[model samples]
Target: MSAIQIYDTTLRDGTQGEGVAFSVEDKIKITRRLDRMGFHYVEGGWPGSNPKDLEFFRQIRNERFRQAKVAAFGSTRKAGRPADQDANLLAILESGVCTATIFGKSWDFHVYRALGTTLEENLAMVADSVAFLKSRGLEVLFDAEHFFDGYRANPQYAMAVLRAAQDAGADMVVLCDTNGGTLPTELKEIVTYVREALEVPLGIHAHNDGGLAAANSILAVEAGCIQVQGTINGYGERCGNVDLCTVIPNLVFKKRLACIPEENLVYLTDLSRYVSELANKSPESRQPFVGTSAFAHKGGIHVNALLKDRQTYEHIPPESVGNKRRVLVSELSGLSNLVYKYRELNLGPERDSAEYRRILNELKDLEHQGFQFEGAEGSFELLMRKAYNGYQKPFRLETMRILTELRDEGHVYSEAIIKLRVNDEIVHTAAEGNGPVNALDAALRKALEEFYPVIRNMRLHDYKVRVLNEKEGTGAVVRVLIETGDGRKSWGTVGVSSNIIEASWQALADSFAYGILKLKENGAPDAQAP
Candidate 1:
């Protein structure tokens, strides 16, 4: 099969997703990144829709991509408006992009109700739009909006619309599953029929309302579509568009069809997360292929099978997509988890020794008390290290006190006093913060920074608290997960207690200890114990 073309619309259709908006700079950054990853086309946005999009086109005009062509997106000329005179078409021409993607109503229902125009008029709109763009020496991708629904309702009219664009010299006539209601089986059949009917190259643009956007796109490619249109992380209106992240891997690895270069495939997970960060959205941990938990093994049977052979639990090597296999230790974990993790961490432990069994029992008991280790590997590492002989703690906490009071100014004031034994010295510190936990963190850092200045580089990245039993309400046991980073990498530590303050302190202390250990491993001079 020929290589499939990837068209990314994250800056265009993707912004239609709720809470997704990008500055012009953000769009340009993404364009360069996509180009580096070898995407065929990047749809900048609809130039005529908003000032931000128009400004994006203006700024992007002076930029050059390595291999990817930037395309300006817009709708067909308005009803009764000449293509040359239409503002939307004129804006596309002014955008200075080499290619233009214009969507025209393909469904009879959309033509009458959405566009409020007759079928013949909509056909003329598509034809005129494409012919005009081609006349301007721009490659035209004529998007047949709602094509699948159009075909279902009025097959002849939908085919006629595609034919109109083809006759008007469109480079490709894209079929869009606008409502995202099409099934893979029927979608493949429709795409096959269209591929047989149209002379122009075929493309599939799918939405994920029915959760089959990736499946539908793959099936469409098998049915002879040469181009696939989607957004990074599947960002789009409502249920989202097809995720190029998911589709690209499946096509390259499973179908043996080419999309992005195989070497570039390793950066797929980073790209997905980078886009999510720029969009101010949390990465979906359960998303296939690129998700954090995609290759994580939790069950004992699964881990045991994986210990002997990874293929027993995984479909592909995690490294193939730039992801690592995670062996999580929990109450459900078997000795296999401990064995695998020991190998991973290079911890010395005999497989059949009493110490190993003791550690395993301790882990299970802690988990039974609501200590989750899957998301808190740093804490788990500390637990394993503590079991080692002749292990010395960097610091020992002596006492800590927190006081909070509401002042007359309608603000709460919190202070923490902490005492610690660091090496041979006694350190005492007091600090104030907006909250009790923050105050404690400040006090602890104030005490430790004198001995381990590496502690100064570490700060809490995220802190999450989950109630183990909500029925207990105020007295409920809480599990606190704290993520800390030292400007380079981050680790998570977990703590559980009925007292929220104690839980936070446990997680916080583990975070500091883990950060110090990591720094020492990396050869930081200040990371040594005094």
Candidate 2:
């Protein structure tokens, strides 16, 4: 098997996505992570295009990389200027990197219309730029911009551009599907034609406008391309670029291509999540191999079968991608599902005992009331622990009242008063907030802290409310999911009720319960527990 190279452009093209911006610090962090992940090349950014990218190339000069080579991206020289004198070409050469990638117009329409240059002039610009860069002892990768679409429009012109790059001594000619509208079959045909036409090694750079970037990249490789360029988690312009998370695994495992080492494959899931979190973007759940919910089972039958033999239902084992199998409990759960869930909670189940029935009945009742146990397994596990006499309450909630007043201008004021009992002492507190839920949570925490000072470490990280069975309209069932974190561990809890306030209270109560349970398990003394 031949070794395939992986080129990541998340910091460059990925940042071209609207509403997506990365600071220089963010670029350095992502580059370091990608380097450690064994990516063959990392396109930091286009130096000379922006101040931040220029600073990145300068700052990164002091850092050392493990496996990935940094490639500075830019366009070819202008129509009128010589390669060395062209500002764009000179900027790329002085970007402080030995490897540089330059894009040239392959489509004649772009040459005449966009660049306002003749076809021969465009070809001269492409060949001269590559030759000049090579003469300066720089590794030049020529990106044939819009190669696939240009081939469809005029095959001869597109082939002419590739020949121009090859004749100019370019290291590699990367075929780019700039419009991202070409299908896999079309890419295969075009790549095959280009591979046979040029003597230089071929590379692929695909976009995801049609959501087929990964598919098209793999197809291009199968058709004889040796290098693939993509982002870590499909982060790029428009629909995003090819997701290397999917492409790497598909090539190494599915297609049996030799690229990254087998041990490096296990880090895909963590690397994918780390990049998403750093970028402050939510990871796609349906993303091929590394997503959180990719191998998760929610249906009763599926969970049951997976518990018995995961291979019976899974395409690839969860561990293969560094992800664990998760059995989600919901309204569709059965006895086997409950049994598996109980085992995960470390609570032994008595198959035919009344306690088992009680637990199952409690879960069903909670589900009917709008509690999604699957999404709030931390809360479910706490419930099981409390039922098994393993949980100790941190503080007691004696009373909670939310007062709301609507102003004439439609502004609203919400205030809450909370009373709690801790260590045979009662504490009362009040707080004002922008909303009823916020005021209630604030007052509750204030009252608890008055009795147990350690409660100050807890905070609400995320709060989500969903209307269940919306046909009920204003009287519809409401489900609240509260994610609480204390700088270390984070857990989610769920609650449901017809009134939004009541649902929020249920989730808030579970948040405290889970937090207190964790503290007790860690051997921290709960001053309020009796």
Candidate 3:
């Protein structure tokens, strides 16, 4: 019921996730992004662990952030090593950050097994580390590593570890669910007990191995934890940390607790995708709140209710989190789907018109033929426009040929020759590529660039091919979905055919057509639609 501090460790713990890495520049950029979005703390990785993180702290040391304090993360002093002389503790002090977060073993089993230190020495390490950092005038957050597990194993020892840090001037004592296996109810009860026992402010750091990091984090907050530490998009070691993307909104909108600035919530989706892009990973399409399909309606029944009142299907306005409502048309779509799309497009037949019904029937038939429009809104938009009287394609493909050659030395080459009629003028071109689809794309662009020069701005960003019927094997119908972008925006177009090349060409052609229409809408020169 109070303001919850959001501590993001995406640049630190997030990189621990397999296949997730970011350059020092990426860390700086994320820091700036999180600051602008009004996060309370941004963990800048352990300076003593890696050179990149050390370089990040060096570069970001002088940069003044608006709202977030960049904390340098490291573990408490090593056993028998004085906190002042410890390399990890000294690195945190040298990082030039105003805040420091240091973790120490809370679980008694970790003391003897992992650290090979006595229980009393572990407590001394926690106390000495916190006191030394506080003496340096840094706001220290003491992270009780494996706190939940420790409390469950030896409740007295875990409380002693936290008390040592608190009595040594730790600004905040953070409870960590390192293994991410704590149930929500158990976590809530434990955190509530800890809250009553400790005078220091409490924070929750949860992992997602058990898939309850987000839920446990929320419960911890309900039970009196004031801060929630997590990573963007749930990126972290093993399963992941709690996803701040999911946590922030739930706290802000549901619990009526302030996290980030509510106005900044509109940028959450873009931030999630931006971080994913920098991480060089594909965004999760089904991720809650910020995913592409978060607010997408596919079934006809859902669309019908959504058309009347979006609250019937949606929990919140998609725009609130920088997402949009999508109504997908497929074999399952009814009249309401067409009605919603037609209204959104602002160009299609009336809801009561026969043309509307015809288009709906055609959409269903095409989907039945393995042409999916759910992920190919560009193709669906094109279908709606083509339904208009006298609508013509910008260019007509006259003929195309592909040749693939493999030599004895194992070198292979593919070439495409294309002929097109643009404004009734013949354009012939040939191009080579790594594959037949790429060659065809190149050849088509080569022929069209002269007439519709805007085509040069378009490039295929993604191409996915799915076998419609795997049982048919070589004879199976294939569905090709191509995502194309014109620098500013992207759209998906789909095609279906038994021949892969033909299917690729269909999607490719639609992608170009849609790109040109988009360019024209934006007032790009020579981007005329036929």
Candidate 4:
């Protein structure tokens, strides 16, 4: 619906994901981004839960948010405590957030077993929490925890709980799939019923245990809910909440529901990658709308069709989200795929030319040898340039050596020496590190840093090693993908070898080469992204 609102819980529920721990500064940073992105609500955190969240509220007070309303989250008052005096409710008020959300029991079982209180007391807790918060000039939202399960068990009690909230003046009453097991159809039915009965605006907060969080949220909207609460990338406890990245695009484009301005949607991919980088997690390459591989074409027939009409392969234009179409080069690639790549890199070779055939054949040969060019766009570009432009090699390797030793106290140390020739000059360098790969990388960079000082800005971000054939055991050909960033944009290079060390070295060298080439071309291509 055009009246739909986007509520982001990334700072609160998102941190519940394993290995996700955002500092107060990080939360504030993300909050500012979301505000600029035009989210209607930003759930800061539970102030009573941790000092970090409390400090976030105090710190965010001075920062001006153009659009987002910072919301503090907490549970309803305890069974015996008064709403104004309860520590949890008081914390929400003291946080100075204009909006507060209080979660109360909607399930009969949790009321009797967990709270050791009557269902009537749970209802009082819900009503009083909302009413009390409203009296303090706070706009309150009430979360009916375990709403779907409670509805499935006793629809009457669930309705009563919602009525308690509605009568108490909550701005919105949210249905929570706390266990995340409800099917999309079930969610739709429950929400339809709630929408038909309640006069208050409805919201949906779904978890993705069944892989249906996004589907359920959409269905809930179709069934009449007007607000969607979710986390970026679906980051949360267990399977995470519905990913707003997927939901926002789905609503704005697919469903024709106005949530944010269409122009702002172009920043969707940029925001997704930015959030993942802040969390120090790689963006899922296959994630629906914003992932690297989402718009990538690999199969021969697919590429042929896509070249004629992208709609044959892509549901939406990649540029809609600030992502470009990627034609992955591999054994499965067809002539059309090579043509696309050649044009993208400005390689002056016609699709039917002999030079095009030569490069395509070489690519096939490389793929057969365990080279995965799909993730190594830099290496693939270098290959094309060398084949067609007679591009001179930037540097020559003279010699390299690495030694690993286990010393006293069970400590291990690695040392490396590298020798390189640049034109008429010879350069040599040595360095020690915690591992063989680290030492080699250090020495190689040291030798090259003098010649290309821009390499100093480049840092290795991620390294992944994959065995091509595990049946060959230790002798299996291994593929290494090294991701490097120069304080801004990141790129990858691939290397393959029977020796892990050799593979790592090849990838490392290519990574540096790619960084240098990119810097020479654009000075700093990624400064605007981060």
lDDT against true structure, model 3: 0.93
Ranking by lDDT: 3, 1, 4, 2
Give a tens-digit lDDT track for model 1, residues 243-360. 9999999999998887899899898888998899899998898999999999999998999999899999898888888888999999988888888888887776555657677899
Q: How large an RMSD does model 2 have?
A: 2.5
Report the C-alpha lDDT of model 3 over 111-151, residue by residue, as the tens digit.
99999989999999999999999999999999999999999
- RMSD to the true structure for each prediction, in A, is 1.5, 2.5, 1.4, 2.8
Model 4 TM-score (2 dp): 0.96
Better of 2 and 3 by TM-score: 3
Candidate 2: list runs displaced more than 4 Å. 353-358, 388-392, 405-413, 449-457, 469-473, 487-489, 522-530
Report residue 181 deviation for candidate 2 (angstroms).
Answer: 1.4
For model 2, the run of ten residues with the poorest summed lDDT: 345-354
lDDT assessment of candidate 1: 0.92
Candidate 4: worst 10 consecutive residues by lDDT? 521-530
- Candidate 2's residue-wise lDDT over 1-530, tens digit each? 35899999999998877666788999899899888878899999999688888899999889899888899999889888988898877877777898999999999889888999899999999999999999999999999999888898998998999999999999999999988999999889888877777789999999999988999999999989999999888888888889999999989888988887767878889888878877888678788889878888878788778778888778887787787777777777777677777777666645564776688788888787768887687688877777775665666778888999998899899999888776668888899988998898888887676555566898998999999898989999889999898877678898888989988988898888777767766777653454
Candidate 1 regions off by >4 Å? 349-353
The TM-scores, one per candidate, come to: 0.97, 0.93, 0.98, 0.96
CA error at residue 391 for candidate 1, angstroms: 3.5
Q: Top TM-score: which candidate number?
A: 3
Steric clash pairs (candidate 4): none
